[model samples]
Target: MSKSLLQQLREMTVVVADTGDIEAIEKAKPQDATTNPSLITTAAQMPQYQSIVDGVLLDAHKQLGDSATDKDVANLAFKHLAIEFGKKILAVIPGRVSTEVDARLSYDTEGTIKMAHDIIGLYEGAGISRKRILIKIASTWEGIRAAEQLEKEGIHCNLTLLFGLHQAIACAEAGVTLISPFVGRILDWYKKDTGKDYKGADDPGVQSVTKIYNYFKKFGYKTVVMGASFRNTGEITELAGCDLLTISPQLLGELDSTQGDLPRKLDPEKAKSLEIEKLTIDKATFDKMHEADRMAHDKLKEGIEGFSKALESLEQLLAKRLAELESRESKLVSAD
Candidate 1:
């Protein structure tokens, strides 16, 4: 008889599906869809996406020549595979898709910028305009610098793996299209640190996003804040008035089935009156602030390494599949 929690949140925030699964995205019907290396790697193993995986590998071998080494094939496949998935997601969602560049390029400013351009080019080549894609990058100093340059070039970016105020402030200053401050991950760090469980408004993750949201609104920054990596429905609801929230399919299902009184926890009007001072974050200041905040420093590094490992696992998978395809082709030739 009443509006579902998801519907309530949508009225205040843009709902985005945080997944690489087409069916999940369809069911969630989120305005935007986001994919990372981990999601892509997981999707590659699914029986349904096997054809797409093989097709991308075959396209790699064809374009790079059969003599291309496994490493070469894997490298090419990674880029194409990300774009391939992004293209499919774009078909179902009308808003935009956040496709990440390689995590290995996180600390490399110039490399991140160059890859962002190439990714946008790939989308354009496929007839999808640049307007429909957000090039997601880490929130390291280098990554923020890269995003700054990309923004000037009209390439929107989603600064991800953000934890501390330093990261959020830098992102807002950089004029990023959006910033994905991980809500659940922050809670994980705090819980492990103090061995205290938190919930609802008391959740540390919820507090972090609220601070960033209020800070952004108070300062009148045009950069959007999209809270991500939610661990539960409470965290999502606490950030009710965020610019956006990229929710996992699990939470989406939970929210869809549950109906309750949902209230707007954050409002720009309330934020404007908060007396938060403007914090200037140059490289030195950012490094110092990052070092002081153990949570942000450790979590950012962990996130990057995790994504990098996932990417490596994906490359290995591609190489193994490539070898199998080659073997099948050789056997067929012998029979002929």
Candidate 2:
């Protein structure tokens, strides 16, 4: 029997499942898993996870007591809800699970730092070691600073919404644990801008990640490069030797079904041999490079807004569920 591409890819690079779908994670048996607000919102609606969702609402409602409205309880439950999904994912994946910090705090250094601590504390209180958790934050300068401080205190962070080399360099200089460069989203921007088809290594997204990976390896940065938001398996196969790749379940399924020669497209030793200029990543440099890269600027803002909206939608879902549960209990009490 020939090895699947996924199996071959795993032999060369760490494969992380990028989703909050626990059953899919369990079935895939990925080494690590990642979750974000949009994914959690989708997963919360899954019938299989209804109990988990309801449980969070109930806990938050009780904690806030009778004075809290459903909206207030829903707000409280939203944070805890992420931890619950993360815990379920952690139970299946042997390695770490990346639980995201609230996206709305992407630009607030203090808020990002504090939320990271609270998230870690939540996992710790639930008996999960911080070692097995990666607090994911946006790759804004402020968020990177937050990760830097959290790293000093021994909390690992995964800088996300990363699309440009400047953001990647800033994260590496921050001594962060990991970074998730948006591969498919970059491809999305280019295709929309140029109205051209991109496949395999020629894909701008794949090239972007490859550049970041080579840059990191060349400079001896320890921050792990995990290509994320893949649009297709071709983009994934093109980044065969990335430190890690967080793949969606749909793509994972496709890779599992396909078999072919998976060659190494990236290597640390090769990167070390290549001459790459080291760019300074100070605040001004980062801002300048970010501004020059229209794609990064637009995508970063768009990604943040999309995530913020997903979180809002999730809050509404929680509120509706809480009301239903509360009304049911009230009717029972009156009947008694």
Candidate 3:
């Protein structure tokens, strides 16, 4: 008998679970996993994850000694939580985990590079090799520049919030490890603006990723393209042979439960057969293209704002926890 549709598709593309929830990740059984500030913040709020965060803080305190400042402790605590979640995810999936840099440093190239190294340093301290972690960065030009340098140093990067070909092409030229072009976010912009629904191969968001995928394959660019931020199964099904696709657990469940022969929609051979022209753009051309594409520009800003807000929330939570700990410590000293 032939393999199931899911099994067949798995042969071509790497499926990554896009969640910080360990239980959901384990259930999906994706080859790789990705976590953003928002997802991590959501996971940290769950009662089940409270002990995990507490344990991380306990370990951070022990490692840094009681003299460690709250900021120091908070950074270490957040890293520990991220790594703990990553460790759990790595057990279920054989591929890398994408842990993001703080969104606040998206435009600060030097700071972004330093933070990326710090994140990797924390992971390496836990016995996880640099190979198993993909430092995620926003797809801004400065972020791309930071990634280019990092890639040369053998640190793999996953460029997130990518929308325009300018970003994709620049990333490809820089030889970054991978680029995640957001699909649903692009769709959301179009849907809200025009009230027109796209179907099957007609999705503008899917088309953006598809164009990038074909461009890379056509030019023999080694950088991988991972379609992300999917809105529906149709977008997922449309880009079946993408290098990778990070999906939410809810969508993964939807794919698993549906009964149909899922077709292979994106074949490199087919891409080559189509005689698509090659594209190489300098800064001027890139800027022009970006200016012409309203959806890409709007979505890119929205994604950055969304991530920035999530990071702020995480910071606020960490601050509150630190203050509580300080209050407890004050009381203990007073009692003594």
lDDT of each: 0.94, 0.95, 0.86
TM-score of 2: 0.99
148-191: candidate 2 lDDT, tens digit per residue: 99999999999999999999999999999999999999999999
Q: 1-336 in candidate 3: lDDT tens per residue?
A: 555555656878999999999899888888899999899989988888877776777677779987888677777777567778777777788889999988888889999999899888888887889999999999888898899999999999999999998899999998999999999998888889999999879998999899999888887899999999988888998998899999999988887777667777787877766677767767777778878989888888888899999877776776567667669889999999
Candidate 1 clashes between residue pairs 3 or more apart in a chain or in different chains: none
Which of the numbered candidates is closest to the native, going by highest lDDT? 2
Q: Write the candidate numbers in order of decreasing lDDT.
A: 2, 1, 3
The C-alpha stretches of model 2 lying farther than 4 A from their native spots are none
lDDT of 3: 0.86
Q: 1-336 in candidate 1: lDDT tens per residue?
A: 899998888999999999999889988999999999999999989989999999999999999996789889988998889899999888998899999989999999999988999999989999999999999999999999999999998899999999999999998898888999999999999999999999999999999999999999999999999999999999998999889999999999999999998999989999999999999889999999999999999999999999999999999999999899899999999999
> Which lDDT value does model 1 have at 219?
95
